[model samples]
Target: MKKIKTSPLLPQEFVVENISENEANIIAYPFEVGYAVSLAHPLRRFLLSSSQGYAPVAIKVEGAKHEFDSIRGMLEDISEFIINLKSIRFKLKNDETDAEVTYTFTGPKEIKGSDLSNEQVEIVTPDAFLATLNEDATLTFTLKIYQGIGFVPSEDIRDELDDGFIPLDAYFTPVRKATYEIDNVLVEDNPNFEKVIMNIVTDGQIGPVDAFKNALEVMYAQMAVFNSEISVAAPTTVERVDETPEIKKLMGRIEDLGLSARSFNCLDRSAVKFIGEIVMMSEADLKNVKNLGKKSYEEIVDKVAEYGFAVGADLSDEVVSAVKKKIEAE
Candidate 1:
């Protein structure tokens, strides 16, 4: 299996199997998935290679809690930045005393030099930017996302607690730096017909297109009921019908292939009870499997809940009873 990290909200039975490297299909993929596949674009080359630009992020700097009554704070002063695509700001509050203060969402530039007057060129190459940080302080910085399709949704994916994204630890595998041979090709012969393709072999969530569409429907419904600020609006249409957009699937050239498979209630014994598997197969595996169809994919995928949990197998008697009670309480 090509190890790709799972999302925290990822369902249980996802795995990757036989794969091929080939062409891209121009389907209306989700925003997050689209962004991931867009990395093959030529535009990214400039962003990744650029030595002058900097990305901005906001963070907190809570000074030593032990020594000072007041904590000092500051906006990560990337005052010398070149590509000010965005800016992060801050305010200070005190004197420092604790062994070390913890900060969230901060960058090396955000830490104030102890002397407060230390002269440092805030804008430097990505390498230099990393080297300037004080070793003693806790830090967090903006991640450089390699987005293939830029859908800068101004929100983090929500979790059950509404606290934030699923922690990386929960994902079964980590994402690898998957590469694409051809990212963009013209969908139509028109001079301006543009199509971008990203090749990724997902640890697919089980279900058919119908299942996915249905799950999406319910997920969107709940999001609206709860008035979530970061929820995705219900898609007007998520079908592969005659009137659907003309997105084409282009096969890969080499050994890379893309085939999706999902199996439910497959396990005989399990701890949490629910068991299943969703696998992305290679061209070879795809050909050997019989009755692999779009409807099947939808059926499997539609079973995934917004909690990123999948419904399958059988719950333990105790577990089911507890779940029933929980639902009743809700």
Candidate 2:
């Protein structure tokens, strides 16, 4: 550590290799140039440094523990992770060009709390309007992901988040966003759920299930087999799952058309089944699928009621407007 005196009381400790005045100022204070990652609480953050250009910079920070014994316990907990580390390579990033490292520390937050009632009831209704669309038309959509639902890399944390109000305080920002994309939208026909493919969008928006179902209209068609020169089977038989054995058998007879049986709850009925909870299926797909009947939906509600759950639906008004605009543009 090189001590450079900028002022009588403004001395700064800098890493060995880079003795630049800027680097000195950056590493001063309770921390050195690099960040320290201590698993313990009452966070004593560490400074990080990578003498070697292409290595991970090891962090040195204080342990979090209310008591001295607890501090020791925390040390023991992290001993394995820090044991072999003599120095970590400080890269511009985990794998990027060199840049100034910036960070801010937040204090032990009482973290605001909220009251939620799991005992509440929710009402959902099926989307008959969405179901009315042509089930045979292949619905192709370039889903515009709704806001507030994408993978925001962790290092993107704001430099002023914590403001480091409390001296020597440290924190670990939990990766908030899920790595997986929103509940998988049935962009393509999946074999398992063949008869009717459901391409539902669940991420980006949050709210009731029925509302969610109403917003999406995914077109589904069966796999078409080309007979080299011959055309396809009757388009009428495509994607429509038949309940009767005769209709189902007839679908198989249609060349290039693979009509298979599929079981699904009716639109309004099923929609009413999950009024409050978040459901992801688009309204059009639910209505297109056979068996989604008022009767079946009622049965679903009754069965669901038996488990002490309420029905519900949801869709974002903004999403509805946006989709409408998209259709207008088309």
Candidate 3:
């Protein structure tokens, strides 16, 4: 009988080695022989079907009552015009779930995506062709833009639209393509490890790396549902002491410490108002505060130590909450 060697169930590292405007190549290594395929397949599916994007859900074109109607002066019939509208990529700049865009043209001129105007939505494919008009022809249209995920058939929105509005089949995924390849790799004298290489492409509305990350988040959300009922008790290493009085003293206003203007302003801008918040924060967390340089961080640490407390002190949640409530009452 042959025995299998022990290997890591999860990949050791995931790195994006190659990236461009709308495409990215990500590689994950040292996954157990079959784990690479297991992880990559679901991620690719999520990237294609779960990523959010914006598309035109319905449109009202002047001189055409329905999708099959023909309009004079336009090179493309109404149906062809609808197809062109489907290819235009968009992104919502605000929190709006939907928006309206209007375009009007009088030509012998070519109609492009840039002609559609909406303040809340950004047209990602400004150069995309929509239609052409002959001399002395007029074109005017209004599009109902919607933010959604996956494919939404026209019939789903047809009954909701008012008269003269033609509903469109919306493909709202920003990921244009997603694929993965798995290959065997050597790890720790073992040759059975697998490496996964994922290639992702997105419409200009979203970057490929962002799309890949969104897919990973969606996958995590789906898997987390199974773990909802499996809560495990956290082990306690030491008994906690009552230090509510000491913590309350530390919870006083930060201005009482007399820190320099630069350090004080930086802490204020970061929304840190009390000395206890600063004392509990680690050096790494302090470094992340905007405009707080090395000198300011060192000064803060020294200042806290002068008060008989050090940064990164671990206080029990009950003590911290009590101190906060006492300070608030004052």
Worst 10 residues of 3 by lDDT: 234-243
Largest TM-score belongs to which candidate?
Answer: 3
Best by lDDT: 3
Regions of model 2 farther than 4 Å from truth = 1-147, 160-243, 251-330
Candidate 2 global CA lDDT score: 0.23
1 or 3, greater by TM-score: 3
Question: Model 1 over residues 274-313: C-alpha lDDT tens digits?
Answer: 2112222233442233554555444444533322333342
lDDT of 1: 0.26
Tens digit of per-residue lDDT, candidate 2, span 175-246: 111111111112112212111111221111122122122222111111233444677555431121213442
Give the lDDT ranking, best first.
Answer: 3, 1, 2
All candidates' TM-scores? 0.18, 0.16, 0.67
Worst 10 residues of 1 by lDDT: 246-255
Query: After superposition, which runs of candidate 3 have C-alpha atoms over 4 Å from their true positions?
Result: 1-9, 232-330
On TM-score, the stronger of 1 and 2 is 1
After superposition, candidate 1 runs with Cα above 4 Å error? 1-171, 174-177, 180-189, 201-233, 242-330
For candidate 2, the 10 contiguous residues with the lowest summed lDDT are: 42-51
Cα lDDT tens digits for candidate 3, 1-330: 545537344454567855789988989777876888988999999999999999999999888989999778999999999888887898877777788777788889998877664677787889999999999789898888888999999999999998989999999999899999998987544688899999998888789888888998999788776677987454333222344568757866778788999999999999888888887788789889999999999888888888777888887787667656544432
Q: For candidate 3, give the lDDT of residue 319.
A: 69
Ranking by TM-score: 3, 1, 2
